[model samples]
Target: MLQEAVDNFVTSIANGEMERSGGSRNTIMAYRNDLGQLCSHIQTLGITSWPRVTHEHIGNYVRHLRDEHAYRPTTLARKLAAYKSFFRYLSQKGVVTTDPALGVCLPPVERELPQIMTTEQVQTLFQLPERDTPMGVRDLAMLHLLYATGMRVSELIALDVEHFRAQDAAMQCVGVRGNVRYLPLTSAAMDVLDRYLQHGRPHFLRDASETALFVNHHGERLTRQGFWLIIKGYARRAGIEALTPHKLRHAFAMHMINSGMDLGSVQELLGHAHISTTQFYCQLASAQHR
Candidate 1:
């Protein structure tokens, strides 16, 4: 009887959710799974009717998920959402006097720390690209600059050839909304940039007037998505499970903070609008040392 009610409720919402979100079969399946577990929990207690299930029963079930099952806060929150939706349906159909799941709050979503690669892992990724070939030279330079400056992928893709002031060994980075910052590059990164400009960039630039620093095979400006694909390919080759442009940026910030670089300077280099944003990396660096 509890299973029948669960099925009906899931079927009722599945169509509407699918129509609205498109391809929401997975979400509907999650709701079904949540209610099935609820039914199993109450059945073990000898409760048979939908109306016999009380608010206390719901609380016990949630506690069981948290304590016995050891579900993460995120998974618990998602289950709570499913519970609320299910009880809301039952309340509307007069099966329950009140919505048991309504007043129950979702678990707080924890903030995930940034993913940082080890110095050895960073070296492994950087060394994957063949420095001699044009594509390899371009990718290697971009990877080095990302780790060197902690710049956003958007800023990396938006780079222009003139932005690389090789004479100063610093990049003239132009951010969104006309904001500009001079990102000091390592002498090594600058050397690669010089090589890319001389041997690599010229080979990629089909249009003589093209000003973009990085170009695709079609000779158009390289996109953020393109850079992401490049990173993923190198990561796979280097045997890293997960890699993204932001991960590289996070790694750069972590390394800088670990090296005793002041948060203010790191903030300036990364072009962060707030000092608070830069402070998170300090915690990461401290935890790593401990």
Candidate 2:
């Protein structure tokens, strides 16, 4: 029965149901990991079926994760979400008459400030060599755009030529769960975008792909991995140690907070569904001011 449950979950994910429900590959993998951990815990108690899961079993699993595994509160919350999703799937499919994990509650997660680059460091990062070479030009634009808009790496990669309104100094991003948000471009960002569009992109275009805004020399859309490499390269060139793409996002958020934007506005700009997620930037900005 446990095997059947796993099979059903996998099949449902593959059948586009998960995507329709706004689940990404990362979300699906996380759920798989969480459910796998639960099953492993259940096996320790000799329970082998979805129907055999009891409230006591769910409680024990949570305790085991907290007490034995010492998982962080956020990790525990993610695991709980996985369990809830799995059980919901089972109930929807009529494989389970009742959901044992329905009443389970995740522990509260502590809010932590993400690492951000200093304004000076941001300035230095953009001081990279301005060469007319394709790679150099693309790297400059990528870094500029990231810092300017605070766009997630995935959102940047998913961008298409049509998403930009270059004449209006804005670009629209379809963020998580397909929510569209408009990002007003900074002068620097607009300049870089203009240069890339005029000089860099035309060199990369091919008949096979035309819609993607950022492309490699091979004319394929710039992948997340490729973007990472570009970021790392620029970091090294700028002599900035331990910098990552996310640091740019952190800096952007904190800068906005420091500039007196409220949490709700920042949340909307970042495409966060919940204002609580954006509140972390406020904390970081306050700490920096202190």
Candidate 3:
């Protein structure tokens, strides 16, 4: 019965307005967990129908999450978004006339300044010995492209061979929500990418591989988890503390913004459909100005 509701919700999402959002399978699964928890909690309180849910019931569920389950503010906020989305789904389907989660509030979260590597630190990190080994060459290209383009890890991994134009010094990539945008590559990034494609990638290929820009030792397209593990290894080798792939993106955005590129251009380059989404980086820049 609960599975049916989840399936219906997901189907509606697919057939309805959210179809254009290009949400991933992982995001849909998260919404399922969140809505399932709310439904279970409501059922435990003897409330079964969606129409029976009220704002107070929503508050109770949030309290239960915070006090009983000890969810963090960010987790709580995500759960709230999930619930809101679920109710919105219900409203669109005429299951409920009112959206009970509409007025529900999320806990305030502090927006902290994003960490970025200095230009010198980036130079030093990229200067590590290149053994002409496959992994070494791939790592060099990966780090260079990350900082150069400010692409998210998922976007980077999704890159295809045809998306890049070597002679034109440009690449087109899809961002979060599947919006495609073009970026002009720096000379340094182009050099590393050229080397990786010509020499390094051929060494990694097995039988009948596809046109993915980066591949693992097995000659398969790299997974997000695989990329993270590789990045962790490289960060340790470079003697950089707590370095993750996103820090490179932060460094890229920070450097671009600080170099006086307007926020609109940054937003477009990052393929953020909403200006509000891109504004967070501006907040990070402002914190540094303080």
RMSD of each: 7.6, 3.7, 3.9
Model 2 lDDT per residue over 123-194, tens place: 888877475777777778888888889999999999998998888899999996899999988998898888
* Model 3 segments more than 4 A misplaced: 2-4, 14-22, 43-54, 67-74, 88-102, 107-111, 119-130, 172-182, 207-209, 232-244, 262-268, 272-282
TM-score of 3: 0.75
**Could you say which candidate leads in lDDT?**
1
If both were scored by lDDT, which would come out higher, candidate 1 or candidate 2? 1
Instruction: Give lDDT per model, in order.
Output: 0.84, 0.83, 0.83
- For residues 106-128, could you state the per-residue lDDT of candidate 1 as single tens digits? 55787677667888999998889
Model 3, position 239, has a per-residue lDDT of 83
Local distance difference test, candidate 2: 0.83
Worst 10 residues of 3 by lDDT: 14-23
Give a tens-digit lDDT track for model 3, residues 132-204. Answer: 8878888889889888899999999999889988878988888778778888899999998998888898888
Clashes of each: 0, 0, 0
Report the CA-based lDDT of candidate 3 relative to the real structure: 0.83
Indicate the worst ten consecutive residues by lDDT in candidate 1. 15-24
